[model samples]
Target: MMLPWALDVARERDIPLAVFWIQPATVLATYYHYFHGYGELIASHAADPAYEVTLPGLSRPLRIRDFPSFLVDTTGGEVGKVVNAVFCELFEFMDEQRRNVKVLVNTFDELEPAALAAMREHLDVFAVGPVVGSSAEARIHLFNHAGADKTRYMEWLGAQPERSVVYVSFGSIWTYSKQQMEEIADGLRRCGRPYLLVVRKDGRQEDVSRCLEDVVQERKGMVVEWCDQPEVLSHPSVGCFVTHCGWNSTLEAMALGVAVVAAPSMFDQPTNAMLIEEEWAAGVRGERNGEGIFSGPELARCVELVMGDGARAVEVRKKVESRKGMARDAMAPGGPAERNLRSFVMEVQSSDEARRKDTNTISPPP
Candidate 1:
């Protein structure tokens, strides 16, 4: 949405511009295809949730439900209309500058190699992430939780056995309906494991309080409005993360070697969930019922499948551990991300120097 204004300002000021894509490289590729050749196919089947669309460089065909929520949103309301328009314009802007622009993606090479490669065919795309580091103090928390005791949760996690707890959080933005909250509460209970759930105390505080009262009273779980997610995921006692599959959360869980039970809600989350369950083989995606609600049994089954004593669970853990090592290597000093970033800086500097020399050489046109 801000791309047009940014580009205009950069061009007017004769400055260099490099787009930093905060989403995964896979999503960039998806959007690239959406605007390039697959838009019509997706638009034709926008109303059909079961319809699948195949794009280049992806191993599997994605259903309409798997596409970014903005594209698949049937709501013709103002919000949807504005979202659709902004994305269309953003892609058009990218297409116009594809020859000169390079995008820095917030993802790592080992994470989405194919997606990165696919985008590189059109533009210079660099994998400069799992941008987060492993330092607890270096973490960035956007929201301010006033007077919240952090040690209480840390102490609770410390007391639990290694890999014995299910950590549930649905990112910071999305709010759940009362029914959905109850279902998730029931699912956590059915999983028969110690759990820690983070339900933001936005508008849904009363509902969340009501739904989680029993579980909280039983001491089987704890519900807080917010916490340090990376810190929690890094804890030894957290075995499985029941997540919304947001990219940051997904990357954090993978980096910390925690297996996931993906419960995606919107946007790039469904795609991230698919990659987590199918591509990476580090987790399982939960099944949603007809009304698009993830049922309690489905959640429990996914949690157990990833966190249980079964062979699949063991295999998932091993895969996640392997990826965790890869993520660490990618973010380490002088690693791929750092090297690519350095190269980009050098390229921009060289370009700017050449431009300055050209300007100096030009004679007065009076």
Candidate 2:
């Protein structure tokens, strides 16, 4: 969101700016196409939810519903208009800085090789991720928990058997409707697994608590306001993650080799979910019913598919395990992420020196 301002300030000051894209490179490419080439194509089909458009880097054709919500939201509504304007300005800003632009993506090279490569044609793209701590000592928690103790959850997780718990968290931003909350609770119960579900302490907490009161009291599941996600994903007891497919959570789950049941809700989530299910083969995307809600049975099916002793489940686990090694290797010292970061710094320094030399060589008009 601060991208446009950052670009403006950097350009005005002649400072080299590298964009740290927080979402997948695929999402970056989507936005790039939206402004550069595919805006008309998207606008033409905005009303057709099932219409499919194939982007350059993506392997499969994506339905209109799969595109970023802003693109298909052509209702002439103020929110849609504002979002469209922001993205348009964002891409225009990138275009203005085309020559000297660098994008530092929050994804490992192995994860989105094609997307990263595709972006490189337009900008200096670097895959310097999973941009997470290599160890507990290096971890940084950006959010203040308001003096909440994290040890209780950790201890509870420690008590569970290895690969026996289902970890469910839909990031902090989106709140589930009461009906959706009940559906998820029912799904978790149907899965018949010990689970840890993080429902943020928001307006919906009380309602969500009411829905899950029986489960919480019966020790079938534990619902917390918040927990250290990375720590939870890393725990041995955690087997499958039901996530919103937010990039950070996606990468963390991949890094930890925890299989996922992607219940993507919005923005880049659907894209990430597609990548997880299709490209990486690390997880399955939960099926949404006609109302665009993931029904309890559908969620249960996805969880069982990911966690059950089936061929697909085994394959997904294998793929996740392999990618886990790749993610760790990429983040290790002297690995791809570190090497690319060092190279980016050097290139920026070199560009700065050359620019200085060019300035010094210019003759005064006076």
Candidate 3:
């Protein structure tokens, strides 16, 4: 969203600019196509949940619900409209300078080869991630130590059995309504799994306090205001993650080998959920009702589908385990992600040197 301003700063200074796309390459391709030619088709069917789009280079067609929420958020009022406008403006800026644009995506090469190749047709694209682990480690060092609440949760996790805990979070920005919060709490309780849920203290805590109180009183789960997410996902007891499919959270789950029950809210989240469930086969997407609320029963069903002693659960776990190995390999020394980063750095350095030489060249007086 802030890419336009960053581009302006880079241009004014004559510095080389590369877009470090925080989302997956598939999402980047979707957005690029939406701006390039498919905006009309998407806009016309924005409210049609069953409408499917076959984007170029995607192996499967995507339903309208699977798109980034901004594209299908017809009833979201002013904020939705503003966000949609911002995306259009941002992509327009990129489209205007497409020739000069280079994208460094936070995904590994083997994960989405087709999508990455499609994006390279229009932009200088590099797949350079699953890079959340090191940054997560760095965050631990910068913070000095975990807080009291964090420590408490860690201890609680220690008490749980291996691969027996459900970790629930919707990233930091999204807050649920009282009804939605109650539904989520009820769902987790119904699933009968020991769970750790994070509810932000962003002034909406009082609204859901009753629901949370019930959860703790029954000893069904533990709720905290905030936590070091990487720590929770890396915990041995955490088996399934009920997530909103935020890019960072998705990557962390992938890197750590935790199965996900996607409950995506907005932005790139829905797309990430699609990748998680359909493309990667690492998890399942929770079903939602007409109101777009993931009801308690549906949530429980999805959770069981991933965590129960079922064939699907076993397959999802196997796929997630495989991807975890792939993520590690991508980040290892001389791996694809590392090699891509090295190549990008060398290109930038070469450009900088050439520019310096051009600036310093002495010309005879005309």
Which candidate tops TM-score? Answer: 1
Q: What tens digits encode model 1's per-residue C-alpha lDDT throughout 116-210? A: 88888887787888876577577667677875678999999999999999999888787878888889888987988999988777736676667
- The most accurate candidate by lDDT is 3
Which lDDT tens digits does candidate 3 get at residues 259-287? Answer: 99999878889999999999999999987
Which residue pairs clash within candidate 2? none
Candidate 2 — worst ten consecutive residues by lDDT sum?
A: 140-149
Please give the lDDT score at residue 251 for candidate 1: 91
Q: Candidate 2 regions off by >4 Å? A: 203-205
* TM-scores, all models, native as reference: 0.95, 0.93, 0.92
The whole-model lDDT of each prediction reads 0.84, 0.84, 0.85
Enumerate residue pairs that collide in model 3: none
lDDT of 2 by residue, 131-237 (tens): 76666678766555765558888888889989889998888687888888889888988999899988776736677678867668769767887788888898999
Question: Least lDDT summed over 10 consecutive residues: which range in candidate 3?
Answer: 139-148
Q: Give the TM-score of candidate 3.
A: 0.92
